[model samples]
Target chain A: MNLALRDIRHHLGRFLLTAVGLGLLLGVVLSMIGIYRGLVADALGLVRAPAAEVWVVETGTRGPFAEGSRIPGDTRESIARLAGVTETGSMTFQSLEATHRDRKLRLQVVGYEPGRLGGPPAIAEGRGLARSRFEIVADVKTGLVVGERIPLGGDVFTVVGTTRGAVSSGGDPVVWMALRDSQVLQFRLSPAPARREAARGPVAAGAPDTINAVVARVAPGASVEAVVEAAKRWKHLAAMTQDDQETILTRSVVEKARQQIGLFTTVLLTVSTVIIALIIYTMTMDKIREIATLKLIGAPDGRIVGLIVQQALALGLIGFSVGASLIASAKDFFPRRVVMLPEDAASLGLVVIVVCLVASGLGVRLALRVDPATALGG
Target chain B: MTGDNPRPLVECRGLAKHYGEGETRVDALRTVDLDLWPGEVVGLLGPSGSGKTTLLNLIGCIVEPSAGTLRLDGETVWEGKWLRPDLRRLRLEKVGFIFQFHNLLPFLDVSENVALVLDMAGAATTDAFARAHELLDYLEVGHRKAAKPSSLSGGEAQRVAIARALANRPRIILADEPTAALDGERAGIVMDLLRKVAVEQSATVVVVTHDEKILGRFDRLFHLRDGRIEDMASRPGDLTG
Candidate 1:
């Protein structure tokens, strides 16, 4: 037992090299796990921001992103009159591509009234949107810092504040602006379309005076389900709890992205397992003659197996530690938030250990098959 | 020579081993009988393909014989079936083997390589290290205990192997051309060390060698030819005949 560990310590350089290789592979696995968690966090951030108990959207629609949701802007006024309706605010959602500093950036525009029920909850830098029409608060992911001017439709809005992790279900950075700007950005007609509309004279854009959806807060001890049921009685509207809205966003808007990430994670894990197995197998093969000699000299089978397994586990632990540290330090450099939770790291560590043990099986078989007589022969 | 002791340390009766079957079968050992007692150093002199290694391997319990009865320290080790399922444990507790190449683990230092055998046999760390140091001192290699095998000369490495063999104080020691890789002076030193250890420990030592220069040191000698024992001499200086 002492001899095994002494031998490994004596050959520290080789072991460290093997461990480093394993560590890099483990880093990729950890990063994949973190990215998946980050996706879920990003999707939930928007719903969590409002601090609203229930949501009102068009009937049979998933949410503001997945399906077209349009209800009269005044629907909030009606919902506010209901029992247990503490407060209500109208909000609009749209994804737009705009130019900033010769670069085209895509953003999910969230429009709301300042100091209202639904708005940018917290600012990481500078002030929140103070003016009603031209000021905007942007997520840092949009690469727009404070005072940076970005064109939305035909108007240029100065970035008044920067927030973190404010992304839509599709991972687009969320930019908060005044409700009128969002409505105009989403529904405003181009010059030619405006001319055509003017020529048509009396043609009315359906629900021309309405905003997209109403977000509402319920009073204490009020049943959200009752309010949602009452809102559904309107012919063109539906109401949902905050949890239901999150489910809609996850299942409808980000389903494909989630599947893509899931497939990628599976592939990376398989590759990591195979890589670890090959390395352990190769190391064992290099020591075949030595193993045979050890067995011939009266070393027990358990000791031999222990040596191999110890080496494998050492490799995994060292690699995982290095990989975990690397991912934690480098996560912020990534384009998306890599949420490395302790539970995720703990589970990944266990998986790496299992991978190492399974990988050592090949080497164990090779070792057990060695004939002690070979040590006696030429 | 007959003594009051009922069993020799090692005894083989009509041991036969054949490789392959039918027309292609070749006899590696054929009906050989031998007895080795404690405090005796014997030399096996043979040409190539003369079953010297095969006989050594059988005595070392590395391979099974087709037909034979082997007794070690009054216990029947191999008859119709193996007396012990743990052959490795048997080897560790009762026998020591030295090969032509020093065969020291390159990753281990001199003392560690020697102590490894005792450690494998479940000896305590301090006891194993003390025994290893004692053996190294006996072989006059104690000063180089911390050096790796790769850093040692041919003679020093072989001495380490000898100390390793004696670490467990086995009843029988099998040396297969242990001095084959050394020059005349180093080979003589290794042979003298083997003789001294054998006499001091009262353990049986068997050396299989093609070297004729050091044949005079053994208490007995056997000459093998074509997988059969041809001659057995009781006197060491009788090789002139």
Candidate 2:
């Protein structure tokens, strides 16, 4: 009705205030949904970005998270000689604590051959690691810029490039280093331990050195499942397709984080719904006497309901706009990535509207029960 | 005695209204009857809780009487049951109501508040606003059209309420203590405005009030006491006697 809109415009300040409050709640919900999607994306990005089709690891162990698996680094040479094996590269994975800009940060160090199967896919700033030993490509979340020196394993390594969204399943930022550096970080023992081992026996000289996981690419037209099964016959190792590796990573590494975020999201949604309901109820109560007057004057029940719903919708819309803007500006400032996808925002807007409508039921009931006769008396 | 001359704009016979039941029962109005014709202003004089409001509510179709027949413009609106289920439509199309407090929606400006009834009656938005503006111009409150109710004086607010009542061009307008909140001068001004609107629009107007000073302005007067119309007078001097 024209009258209702006019009333809302006339009281635009209060209406806007209410809407802004609702928008903030909607924005938070949207960001939460986006973060969940980002988590899945981050976990799959490293595996999916590589063109590899099959992974060879120790038998009966989920490498990269569940257990450590080290095999002879030269296994790649043997795997490359096998039928249907197009290309193969050995990679080492280890988690390390490093100091960047005087801040202690945990990083997942990945070692791979330069310009080979395993490496940083894309660089957002600077250039990808060019040298083999001392250069590193770190995720931008580490706050390390190009030319910055990071202290890791009692040595300073220069940051050559920065990548975006390259985080491990545990949310630790990933850093790509030379294979030798990764192996040293993973297998190098302290002097006390190395000397202690040497003292225990006459260590075999020229023995084969072991490294973690061999990532391989299958020849075009080769069935990945068949190649994986063929590689499984080796008693000392297991083979997995890219998809299976992703599932293992999610289940083994990020399951607890997912559960924690999911619980937080549910709690936030509940709080948002309750906030909307309370606001609608309060606004409706403020107009009870006026509603009775309208009813007494023969305004139809539908008209009354329409007015309340319109106000509720307006509040939700306003709140969502404010909340979305706030989240967009503040998301990156959070310690974790707060992904704000467009579809997620759109869905959140719909949720806000639905919550507003559902929230208005309490006020509508109160309004319908208002006795029109109350408007007649003093 | 109904003919082509058109019955009184409002007619109530043996109208009775009771509240509660059994031991706690109270009679707010008992066996009251009154008539209001077009182009006339009638005053209902009574003290507080004397059934003046009850009679107004009954005529306004807001409250149904326990026993009575009410006719408006020669149409029987109530007998044992409400003749029309959509009383809201009946009110919007046939009757107008004014209250002492003005009761203009505070969130809406003066013009929008006046136009609300016409908008509810399905009039186009432009047409509703135009009618509201025209009525405000008639009542001389057009200058304050864009102002909210709180910004206006008591007299201006009451005038806006009157304009709203007349926006739908109803056949009858019911004013319950319309001047109860104003001073003597403002009350007289409001009463005079009501009289002018009723006569000019050719609509019946009923003013329920305890203000004895404005008794002489009405074409007819009725005295309500103890929930019944005990005294009726065609002239102001009948009460003094």
All models, DockQ values?
0.71, 0.67
Residues A220-337 of candidate 1: C-alpha lDDT, one tens digit per residue: 8989999989888888888889988888767866677778877887787788778777877887777776787898899998888887888888888899999999999999998887
Candidate 1 off by > 4 Å: A189-207, B1-4, B237-240
RMSD of 1: 2.4
Query: C-alpha displacement of B34 in model 2, angstroms?
Result: 2.9
lDDT of 2 by residue, B1-241 (tens): 1233456888889989999899998999999777788888888887778888889888988888888898877888899999988888888888888988888899888998988898888899999999999989987899999998999998899889988988998878999878877788878887887777777767888988777778788888888889999788888679745
Model 1 residue A226 CA deviation (Å) reads 1.1
Clashes of 2: 4
Measured by lDDT, the strongest candidate is 1
Displacement of residue A35 (Cα, Å) in model 2 is 2.5
- Candidate 2: residue A368 lDDT (0-100): 88
Which residues of candidate 2, in runs, are more than 4 Å off? A1-4, A124-132, A189-208, B1-6, B182-189, B200-202
